[model samples]
Target: MKWEKLGLVCTADRFGVDVPTRVMVPTPVFVNEDTIRVFVTVCDKDNIGRPYYVDVDARDPRKVLRLSERPVMDVGTAPSFDEHGVVVAQVLKTRDGKLQMYYSGFERFRDVRYKIFTGLATSSNNGESFQRVKTTPILGGSDYESTFRCAPFVIEFEDRFSMWYVAGSSWETIRGKQVPRYSLKYLESPDGIEWPVEGRSCMELQHDEHGFGRPWIEIDEHGTYHLYYSIRVCSLAAYRLGYATSEDGLNWVRKDAEMGLEPTPGSFDSNGLSYSAIIEAHGSTYCFYNGNDFGREGFAVSKLIK
Candidate 1:
C-alpha cells in the first residue's frame, strides 16, 4: 500500500482562543452531497482537549469549508466521569440515519497520572451538537481494562454494534515518568449506546511496543476488515502506525510494516503519528492523522496512492 500526502488542513491556532495548543484525532461526519465534516480534538496549553470540527468539500477533502465556532460539547461537570478533558475519536451514522458519537473522557487519580473511559453522545441536528447518553461512562474499569479504556472506533451490522478499543494492561516508568501500556480489546452491543463493562482482549503489544492508541477499521466490499492503530515504541519514545487484517473482527493478522504511513521527514509529522481516520472520496481514500505534540502541530491528510 502507498499514500500521497495532502498537507495540513485545519490547525488549533485557527481557534484564536487562549493558546489553542493542539488539534488531534480527525474524525469525520458526512453532512450532505457536497459537504464532509472533519471533527478534531483541540487542546489548550494545559492539555485539556475539547472536540471541534471543520467542514470540507466532498470532492476535495483538503479544501476547508467552515470551522466550528465553539466546542460541539464541553467536558462533564465536576465529580462526573469526564471532569478533566474530552477527546473525540469516532462518529458513526446509525441505521436510523442519526449521528452517534464516541469519545474518551479524561480523569485524574492519585496512583496514576490519569485514566480514560469511553462515552457516548448523539446528534439529532446532524452533527451540530450532541446530548450525552449518560453522565457516567458505559465502559471503564472493567475486568480486562485494569486502569483505562479509551480511543474507541465502532461499526454496526444489523442489530449488533462492533467496537475496537484500547485498554490499559499495566504501567511502566520510563525516565521517571509512568507511561501506560495498553492492548487492543473488542466488545459488542445490541445497541450502539449500551455496552458491557468487560471486553475480550484481542491484540496485545509486540516485544518493542509499550502501548496502543485509537483503533480504526474499514470493511471492504469483500467483507474483509482492515484495522489501523498507533503503537508506542518504547525505545524511540514516539508513536507509529500499525496495520492488521481480520477475517472476523475477533481474530487479526498483524502487518504493521504494510500500514503504508509514517512521519514525513522535515514535515509536521516528522516526530510521530497517531489516531488514524480514513475518508474515501472521489477516486481516492484519504487518511487524516495527528502529527507531533499529540496534535499541537495539528493534523494532516494522506491520499491513498497504492
Candidate 2:
C-alpha cells in the first residue's frame, strides 16, 4: 500500500488549550458522516497527560471542526493506577450504544521509570464526557505480564473480541539510557471487559529493534489481516513504522519493507514516526500518526493511495 502524506493536523499548544506540551496518539473514530473525532493525549508542564480530542471534517480531515474544552476523563487520584498520566489508545462503540475507550494508564516509580497498563472508560453522551469504570486498570499486572501491558487495540467480531497490545516484563539499558523492551501480543475476550491473564506473543523484537509501540490491525473484505506497528531500532534511536500480515491473528509474518510511509526530511517527523491509527470513511482510508519526540508537534495524516 502507498500513502500520500498530509502535514500536521493538531498540536497541544496550537489551540490555546491548557495543556502546553505534546499531543500524543491520534485515535480517530467516526462521529458522523462529516465529523471524525481524533482522540489524543495532551500533556502539561509536569508531563501529566489527559485525554482530549479534536474534531475534523471527514472528507477533508485537515479541516478542524472543534476541540475538546476539557479532558474526557482526568487522571486517577494519587496512588491510583493512572495517577501520572493517561494515553488514549482505541475507542469503539459498544452493543449498548455506548462508547468504550481503551487507554494506557501511566504511573511513575522510583525503582523503574514508570509502569503502563490498560484502563477502560465509557462514554454515553457521544464522547463529550467519560467516566472510568474503575480506578484500577482492567488489564493490570499478571503473572506473565508483570511489568507493562499497554497500547490496547480491540476489534470485536460476531462471537468474541480480539485484542492486540504491547507487553513486556523487563527494561533494558540502551545507549546509556534505560528503556522498556516490549513486543506485540494478542488476546481474546468473550466480553470486551474481561481478558486472559496472559497474551500470546505475536511479534518479537528482531535484529536491532528493541521495542514495539502501538499495534493497529485492519481486516480486508477477503479476511486478510494487516498489522501496522512501530519498532524502536537501536541503530536509529527512534521509532519507525513496521507492517505485517497474518492468516490467523496469532501468527504474523513481518513485511516491514512494504510499509510505504517514510519520514520526511526536515519535517516535524524528520526524526521518526509512531503510534499510527487507521480509519476508513467516505471511500477513503487514512492513517493518523505521531511524529518526532513522541508527537511534541501533534499528529498528522496520510491517505492510502494503493
What is candidate 2's TM-score against the reference? 0.97
What would the per-residue lDDT of candidate 1 be over residues 144-254, giving only the tens digit for each residue? 676788889999988698898988757898667789988888999998778887788998888888888789999999989999889888887889988899999889999
lDDT of 2: 0.90
Q: lDDT of each structure? A: 0.86, 0.90
Clashes of 2: 0
Question: Which residue ranges in model 2 land beyond 4 Å of their true spot?
Answer: 15-19
RMSD of 1: 1.2
| Candidate No. with top lDDT | 2
> CA RMSD for every model?
1.2, 1.2
